[model samples]
Target: MNSGLSKRKAFLQSQKNQGHRITFGFAGIADFRSFIGQEYIAGMLKAASDYDLNFINFAGAIKYSFFDDIDFIARYFKTFRFMKKPLIDGLVTWTSSFCELTDVKRVEDTFNSIKPLPMVDIGYLDLPGIPSVRIDNEYSISILMKHLVIDHKYRKFAFIGSETSSPHLERLKCYGQELQKYGIQELENSVFLLKEMNSADIAAAVNKMLSCHDIRDKKEIHCIVTPSDLIASSVIEELDKHGISVPKDVAVTGFNNQYSGVFARSPVTTMNLEYFKRGYAAVELLIDRIMAPKEHFDTLLVPTSLLIRQSCGCFEQSILEAAEAISNSEEPAFSLSTKEDFRPFILEKLRQIFPNLNKNKLLTLADSIFDDIQGQKKESEILRYFQSLLQDLRKEGLFVNSEVQQKLTLLRKTILSFLPDPQKNQMENIFHQLRILASVFIEYDTIAPREDSYLMNTLSQIAINFASAKSGRQIQDVLRYQLGEMGIPGIILSLSENMTSDLGSTSLELILPEPPADIQKKLPFKITDPAFIPKFFFPQGRRYSFMVEILHHEDKYFGFTFLEIGNPNISIYDTVRTLLSNALNTVYLREGRSKKRTMLLTGEELKGILNLSEDDSSEVHNGLKASEITGYLLEHLSEMTDLDKMARELSVSKSHLVRRAKELTGYTIQTMHEKLKIEQAKKLLQVESLKLGEIASRLGFQNQNYFSSVFKKNTGMSPRAWAKRYLH
Candidate 1:
């Protein structure tokens, strides 16, 4: 059995063991610099590696491109020679140029010289003795021509050849043979060889072909076929520069069903080579060869199918016909049509634009649009309707861009113009402009369009503000900016010092205003106990003052407004209540609702819910009070006087210490103590030679066990886990 096959089989069998591990090696002529080759091979190898099947590419040792120097080739093989016996379960080659064997004789001679390793050629497998997976290039190209000639009735064809590669050679030959069977002669001059031609060279070639006297006079080329869609696109660009439109003037077809080709202004009708699946299959075949060394080395030729689109003039007639019908309609013009009539038409047009759209999503979008526009008059009235429609379109997996939007807008306008109208033509025009503008707004509003880095920055800013000293102001500022970015209204958070005054008391009472009615009704609000406390005695019928009010600016609702701490006292109860109140008020204001009734919780009420004793002197009830505990913990944490230790020393359970500390200091004892420990650990880790186990042991673990467990639990993972994952 070949070494390559032996290695792959070992790898696969190891994977089945649930604990077995193995690595497969991939060898190619080109260096691992080309994005296409690198990405494809990397993806396959990574998958194999993830499945406990290790994959190593020979890319580091051998250049991806064909080696002209004999020394380079010798070094490449020599690198492999040093690898242990059965180094690769299977050797997978992408292009024939990468391997030592250029022919059958080379295959036998080379493997005979080296230790036996199974080899699988991806495309160029001349040796029937080796396993391979390749596309039926000849058959695929012939099918493409047959479709053009028989179905599309396209004749006077031209061929674009990638003369440097074998696949192109086979395609060109098959194209000529197929055309000949139909009593067609492929003119020698009609064939253009694109060998290392840049954009300018390609453009020149296109110009020459178009300007050819014989071709021009005789109209010899009605349709041109290229070996790849990228080349077809270049041809299209060149022809477009000469004002010769594709499909309309000279129909064009290309191979490789790339999405880029379909998204081209004129979608290209190309062959679906199923590259992803082919890559997947290749790996599977390589794995198979590794496991079964004696199995016959078979060539597996994958089939290709055509994906017809506008580039080949396939859907041109339907689109033109639809456009003409709309232009000729007798209905009064409007900007948007009734959802009932508009959705189906839009769906049809969109299907033409993107053939891959799911039928279910198309129907769902139509339903959503209909629901949105049921009785809405103004376009903005159904703003959510349009938003929902856009979402549905997204679910279809069609790339929505400016161009798609423009086309959709036009289609919507046409449909709306046909629907019944009051002002008729004038209303239609006005609504049309509004719908376009609204679509643009909605497009920009989509979070999907933003890059990850920008979103991360926004989130980081929010987190920083939430943790700031002047958190109330910071929160308001952050919310304001976020709302603006979201195109919502502005908000303000106010702190009223005189809202609550009780000279003898350690707690302050504050009042928060009700949110707008629209916002309030649409949203629910709840005040937590920690942020608000009933501390000041209120005179009968006297309204208590609060610190926050969420507002709306320009008909848009801003986010939660927070109240600043007053001079009287900022307690855990106050912070919790205030945050909860602010959150509720923000939601209400955004929903445009009025405050119904202010709900207040007394110290007794909070104590009952918290299951705390009324005489618990250590209990802190406000965030301000919590800060005192945090400060104490920070100061005494390294003295073996940690919160938990203190709790144990004081003959109290850790839970009791946490509750009492939170009530008295406004911060959780656990939170404060954890921060202190982490700080100390960082300092110790930086200076000490202690192993993680020793460090954990020193941290007061029963052994290193509890210390490492707590360290990781507080942080993210265990101390040893973290060290192994990130320290190095």
Candidate 2:
């Protein structure tokens, strides 16, 4: 063995003996600007940071609907293969997002492959061993339904969503249960199960629902309840085209208080999932599970709240609602909320405002001011007293302009109620002068920074750099230069041997912080080796963290890249992976002549999505190149059979190869291999000349009966019937 290899092994073993810090892996298809990605990732990262924990965020854009091409799915999802034990102590994944890649069971089976490694789902995937921290969808939907039915008094209603979503189904069930409580049956046209939840499909569903009744008719649907805010916004626009206005003509409500709903034309009435808290809770749960391996953990249902807005026909703003908004203030001072049966609401708000100040002192201040006003103290004396209070607040460093204004307003209102009609105008004059005096002491910022514009410009430059690179070396050069600019200290580039799915060995093409001369020669090593990356890559006796992402395009499986998680902005990590993936695919096409090159979307497509001005960008639609690459992957994989044989031919361990297969197709290597065989079997069965026995033997099936049984299990039909139906 090479000396570099021996040292690398030794370094890793030594670190292991010392019992290094626990590392958690967070995997997500991070479209960072999107609702779930932004909120959940932010909360998770915040918790990890606060606890001083090490986390590896395996991020990529691997949505199946983003590309029509089959190969892209295979390449995009290979990022998940890096979620192995020893590298990471526990896995925290957004499994609901995985439903965008393939079936739920496939995702389940793939995660199940990594058993005994404590895993927590951040999204709604309810597998047996893995506990999920998800929004209480049933409770959220019930709250929404009650608002629509009882508050808005909507008798006739409709529910719409993509047929494939598990959450959507759960919502539909809740919608049904809610309707049943009111003694109303779900009418035939009242439900819209769309083929997909994009704008076109949702709009078409809306049109179908509206076909039976004119806008003026009494039978028109009162409200359209959607599973997402994005869909509800689309439905609102579609209604407008036909001369129907939201709330005025028909009320509309949506779930998930995303920007799409918050910034909608009418500002959609929806549910706040509080995903940030859920994300924090998920990390806490995973850590507990990791610490106590034998302890049983149950699913955590994070409570969601209703966000009432104009679209729901509830224009009257409740005092409690207004207070809640103030409680979630973005100001540096404490939030304001009231206790149900404690002191006065205003007193509670005051207590939170000045926590350091004694409660008795606050009450005494209020009592003294009120007592003087009631005693008919001179107006000038009262004015002087108020000014002194403002000065004291400033001295105490409690002069948040808004909170100060709240205190002044509360005092002014109370004083006015105590004074006579003539004295009220004098009191207002005194308060007006105090406001002017307060402004003199406080410096208020009038202009907010244009961070959005600056971010867009920076991303544009980075995207152009990646897009222009034409070769593997050029791509690596771009990565080397841009790493520092993206706030990343260094990166480790690894490539699968021969750019194939074979995981036996990987070439460590580049490490940003070059190793010392003795260990530098071991450029690539077999994955089965003790250490995939040398211990010298990390700082000695210091806290360290790193992230890994897959590098591939279409059906061409390259490898994965490892880097220190130096950048706190999760979006930057995702964006970098995208640029790296696209650039690598371009290089692969240039070098390999036998393979057909698949075109990837330009950086402009990314710019389009990031363009916050484009409201319609929130809606998924056809012709959108939000995907990575295009071509066939399964069409190629279908030719292979026998997981053990495939592993042997590739000269890799079966378990390692199986993980690659699972990451690619969300199935075990053997299961996916069988699925591939069945796909081939279907084609052969379509041919009239081929006998069932001949087709079975040709596709590597054990026997005719076994092939038939497998075929039936997969396709829900026997081979004879399937052939009879399709045969010409």
Candidate 3:
């Protein structure tokens, strides 16, 4: 048997002893780094890895340019389904994002293979009776419709959407349904659906709607609703080229609001689908499925948000009034309103803008805004009231999220609407200040992802370096370069030597800012608790934080990684920590494997061992010939006693085989046969249970005495006596 086979057997044997373990498989149509997989899979896996769990990620290959997109996808799924096994506790899949109804059968087939086990589907489409975590897109679309009808008061609207997928079309269908809800049914002139998602196709749809007589001439088409912010952006841009200004000429709304919506010329009104929460929920539901398998599968529709921006005619009258009121530069002309008057108005607008806000929080914010305005405070103080209110809403916990940046933009504008009117220059001045605050909010949103991008790129490079690493130093270089370039400069990496329950006097494996030549000992921290409590050491005067995470490979701990933390770039920190543990384990295990390997040599004491050297011990120069010939002989020894037959088995000529055999060992085929038989007999000689006649028959000797004579020639001892010498 081969060493690779032996290693595989050992691995399988060890797996049998690993008590109960949970391993998850994340499968998606797109590759891990692609748009879809990053949102739905990697984030949860990164979080899960810190705990005692195993994650196996399956995604399409990046560099298979030889195959077309269709071909590659088919092959990707073909391999992805077969990769499933009993070991994978659950699967988190996104099938219909990149694939649609056409591939549903294969997706169903794949899911069925993992049936009876938990499967959490976060796809656009899911199989019947499987727990599906999907965005409640209907509610998101309904918010846009309600905003258009009640707030902007635009009943007639054009819908521009593409059949990108059925779910995407379902969102578009909501537009007509929403318009009809307002008693407007003749939507033929205002609806344009595109076959392709390309800009040319979208532009054609816009032109087709403009060409319609009902829509062409100032018909009450208040806004154009699009299925995606990307399409909304294109529609707005195309409409711009035709001299139609958003909110000035018409309003526009988009779904799945993205950066395109936030930064469009007249920032678009869109939806926030809560990207991370969806992934986290998927895993949570899958875990629940395991813990309680009898629970009915549910289609969990998460909360959604409608972000009102300038494009959808949000805060239109407020802006004009604010500008007019500020130009006068005097305080006057306030609403003769009591707390009751202001309270309902403020709460209603806030509830519309931030639908997700708790009622208590909304009441608190409304009271603050009301108190400031009723007091007739100075404009700056008044602006701070609103500013502080916006600031309070942005506290990290109230779902201040990736998409909430747009809500902040819209919310500040909504605040301007409730300001005391005709307080000349006061409203406009406050609005301008609000713009500045919004810019700061925007800047905060912008800087975070830039840091994330830098971290992702750097971490990707570090991963590449770690994969090709030949030694532990190369692994350390990855961290050194990462810390020096992107991470904090002042840091120490104290790598633990042992992974036992106790770290056993942790030594600093690599420390930055090398000590002077005279200092022989760069000290290691004595952290008694293996949990790595942060209080152990602090660099004096620097407010550096630390996290001690156990470095593990599967279930085995390799070491603990101590990180100097400050304003975390989360993805980078997680990647480096995970790669560090994996790298150290790789280095440690490779060296251990090399140390543990025993030398297999030809000897009477171990003649039957696989890889036992079948060569003259003294002849080192002819190693390759003996090694190659021994391999062929090991498998075919029972069949190759004759020169012709041996040559035929080896695919060599009889003359060539005999000549090589003699040149290497000074033996004919017949003599070599006797020698091989005697060697085999000696190997079995230690087994006293085999009678001498039985051993002779097994070795193909004529009789027991003949087998003994051949064995004696090889080992200078008779078979029974040889067996007695070892077995006794």
| TM-score to true structure, per model | 0.43, 0.56, 0.49
Worst 10 residues of 2 by lDDT: 624-633
For candidate 2, lDDT tens digit of each residue in 250-306?
788898887677556666899998988988888878877876689888888999999
**TM-score ranking, high to low:** 2, 3, 1
| RMSD vs true structure, all candidates | 25.9, 17.2, 17.3
lDDT order of candidates, top first: 2, 3, 1
lDDT for 352 (candidate 2): 60
Please write out the lDDT profile of model 1 over residues 486-555, one tens digit for every residue: 2223222322211221110111212223244543352222211111221121111221112222222222
Model 3, runs deviating above 4 Å: 1-25, 29-88, 98-106, 213-218, 316-437, 440-728
How much lDDT does each candidate structure score? 0.51, 0.64, 0.59
Per-residue lDDT over 1-728 for candidate 3, one digit per residue giving the tens place of the 0 to 100 score: 66633543354335434543455556665432223445555455544443334454454333212223343444344333223333356767776654542455656655554455578888776676577888887787888788888876676777877765576788877766776778877556676777888899989988887777333233667778888888898888998888878877878888775666766788888887776678767766666566566879668888987766688877534455444544544433336468787778778877987687789878876776665555455545545654665566566534344344355445545555445555423544554675656555755654554334335666667777777776777877776766655565534565544443222224455655454443315345433222222222324322233333445444444445545433334334444556776777777777662222111123332334323445555433423364445544543333335556556545577777777766665666567667666666665554433478865765557777877777787788887888888777
Q: What pairs collide in candidate 3?
A: 325-424, 325-425, 326-425
Candidate 2 ranges with C-alpha deviation above 4 Å: 1-18, 63-70, 148-156, 180-189, 204-222, 315-481, 495-504, 507-536, 539-545, 553-559, 566-571, 574-728
Pairwise TM-score winner, candidates 1 and 3: 3
Q: Whose TM-score is higher: candidate 1's or candidate 2's?
A: 2
Index of the highest-lDDT prediction: 2
